[model samples]
Target: MTTSSNSPPLTPWGAAIITGVLLFLGYVGFDQFYLEWIFLLPLLWAIRDVRPRRAFLLGWVAGIVGHGGGFYWIIQMFQQFAGAPLPVGIVGLVLLAAANGVVLAVWAWGVSLLTRGRERHLVWIAPVLWTAIEKVWPEVFPNYLGASQYKVPHLTQIADFTGVLGVSFLVVYINATLYRILACRFEGKGVPWRAAAALGVTLVLVVAYGEFRIREVDGKVAAAQHLTVGLVQTNRGAADLHLSAGAIQQEHRDMSKALLAAKKADLVVWPEGVLSLGLPSREGTIPTWALGDLKVPLLFGACLQLNEEGETRFYNSALLADASGKILGTYDKTVLVPFGEYIPFGDVFPVLYAWSPYSSKFFSGKSVEPLKLGPHLLSVSICYEDIFPTHIRKLMRGGSEGRTPAVMFNLTNDSWYGNSTEPMEHLALASFRSIENRRSLVRVTNTGISAFVDPAGRITSRTGVWTREVLVDRVPLLEGTTVYGAFGDWIGWLCAVISLGAITLVTVSNRRDLTGKQNAL
Candidate 1:
């Protein structure tokens, strides 16, 4: 790609800083999502005339600042959850931001390599590389560029077909097109109206499709049966100095009783790990007092310990109980949080556990199964498991009966991050599960952002942070699955394959060119 002799007089570092800060603003507090559409312009323009190595460095610079700012809460998270000191927490955040930076660095390098001879293809090439790299790159907290647009329902409805990465693809596509237009003007060339027109048409079609789908999904939700669910948020710390296990349990029971007194509810849910004592995994072992006077079915997070022939196993689980306190079913959390729940490779290197003394050692659940409450089958996710789209799809896909989930439930404890944007961000990502599977999601968290999201990805009701709230809503029980629930991130997988092919071709071409030059020499 060619740069103008009279282009904007900004240095590469200046451009990187602008892109990075804009990206930070687009995702976090004061979320100006529109900035996401144009944030990449500066970096893309700066890298147009640079070598691949320089482009990669520029990309890393922008990524470090952007990711660092967006994920600043990591410091507090480590401090609270891991009990790490300030210096250690700061170092952890730096390492995290640097690691995430590598994804963008690869994208910039790939774009520079691909556009060596073909400059005009930047519009498509950049977006494809960006989407592909972001898809394949693994992170501690998995998120996509599309998540920034979570509040914008019209732009997010396409997730039912292609998942969140599809939304990321479209956002980058717009950025690349805008960059192309601006680059043309800088070089004193004619504006690429055809490219602009293509972008406009694509957006129009996307919005139009979103409009149609929203209306259709809303109709489906209206026609479906509704379940009155009560969500209890206790506003207690993850490990409070004052509250005892019995006291915490009492708080939930009191709130639940108030809900029953006001209106009837089919189910009442509590956040993850509220019950500190490990309940033995045996029939007739569930404490009757746990249910108290409420006659309704109750589901709450607890630790279950099973003693087999000669060993003991601990599970982070959600146990469902009948009106008389009979244990009906249990859905153990399948996707355990790294470090928070269990150390990665801790068993192999036992010393790692010694180094981080607070890390948990719980085992992952065996399968994804929905707990049945009467006739309605409830798909359950504990804590951050709801953030994973494919995992949720598997749970909602049904167990042996081949019947989809009537309603989805996520029991989470957000007290780990305190009063930060983490809860809000978590809510944003979890809301898509309802849209993809066309089920109402009832999320109950310990320290706020407890919400009810409908099939249209609309936040029906939500509670404030650090507040004790008893949210009662008639959550719709949906029946059908969308393309995403059935197929599972097919678009992202396709993009990854394309990216691998492109990287292979580029490497082969570079090697052939080097061989020819050596022969000439």
Candidate 2:
């Protein structure tokens, strides 16, 4: 059971499988969710008294199972949209899961050191390290464990100040504390009062803060001037594989027109990549569409191809068109989705990807700018770009004119995910941005879950999956910056620093102890 053992107890395969399955059940990943506190208990138990390498392998297996299970929706997406073979899509899913497992392997080794040896006192550092690891998790596949708790509003409001890292830390802290208590019990220790008491107080403050935040945001939202925005979900996505670009554009235009029959909206939004033809969309031009007959400004996604220095570059752009059919501004998505948009390291290692999808690259946007929508300015995120908190903060910070947007819009096309759980999961992760910035957020998707989220991170209006509907609602736009809105990624950075300090402390202590033991001998 010594921490310096080169070989220790081997973890059974059953333990790893159980740990991963439990972790998967705790994710927004599934149709039903289980208690997150119990998710990591098995892994901690499996790794106890085991060598660091064995612990790492166990954790890696758990991660592979959990990640692959939670993100299985990706397989359906690839087959539906990318025209990928069933076997190829499955392989893609496994590859992604294995890639993410590396992070868990390191975490497993760190946890072994933290929960064992003379440095076991650093077990309390678990939450900090967990948050830092989440921040390190691939931005392309953003399924942070904290997102699963979005349904629990009381625990979610803490995201306002610390961003999602705070909620993630809290959840991980509970898991760590519970694991510690169980480990101590096995060792004949009654209880870890110091760590337990600290965790108890932290939970108390988290709940208390959530209540105060809810009350404060309610008052501000009630008194604030509301903007009426219409979200159009045309139910036209790449999944169908039959709808031509022109047909998709027509469906969106028809839906928007039908929605106007109810009441005029200040601004109308479309899902990303909905605009194909019937408008001057391709060839880097915005021609007049049937939407020109309407008296409201339109914001929608388009595929823009332009020639730069005799070289052609394509972009996934969200363009604004006035009622007069004049082009206003186009916000090209700066943060593109990996694999889905472009392959990572495709330029450096060309031979790595012979896949056709990886061959085409969409040029990244240099800047993120807010588009004008009637009297209020709107910050837009195309596709998966909305999930990045750092990028959303830049919008709140405003452009060179310092003209901050009162509303934020996320244009996404999730139909490729099919009837899977991703639409809701994606929505949950994006909701944190609303609270972080204290701005009204709207998601206009190609298929379903089109919603309007208030500054409190509450979903005021939402549509069912695969529904073709237009959501017309009043969005409460709160002014002024929030604590997290002003300080971007500070919490994640702080957790990273804490993790490094913990590692150093444990490593140095272990080294000194070995030296002292040798001298005594």
The number of the candidate with the highest lDDT is 1
Assess each prediction's global lDDT (C-alpha) against the native. 0.84, 0.77
lDDT of 1 at 271: 87
Off by over 4 Å in 1: 1-10, 241-243, 280-282
Model 2 lDDT tens row, 1-521: 22222333443556677778877777875634446766777776777666778778888998899888888988987686555789989998898888877666677777877667643454456677778888876645766777778777778888878998888888878888877776676667777888788878888888888889899988988898887888888776664424486676677777788888887787888888765333333323344564535667888887767666567778888888887767777788898766667778987986645765523477899766687666677888887777888888887777776777888998888887988888988888898898888888899888888998887788888998988888999887667888898777787888888888878887899899999999999
For model 1, where is the 10-residue window of minimal lDDT? Answer: 1-10
The estimated TM-scores of all candidates read 0.95, 0.91
Candidate 1 per-residue lDDT over residues 389-479, each given as its tens digit: 8789889879877888888999998888877788888888898887777778999988888999988788889999999889999988777
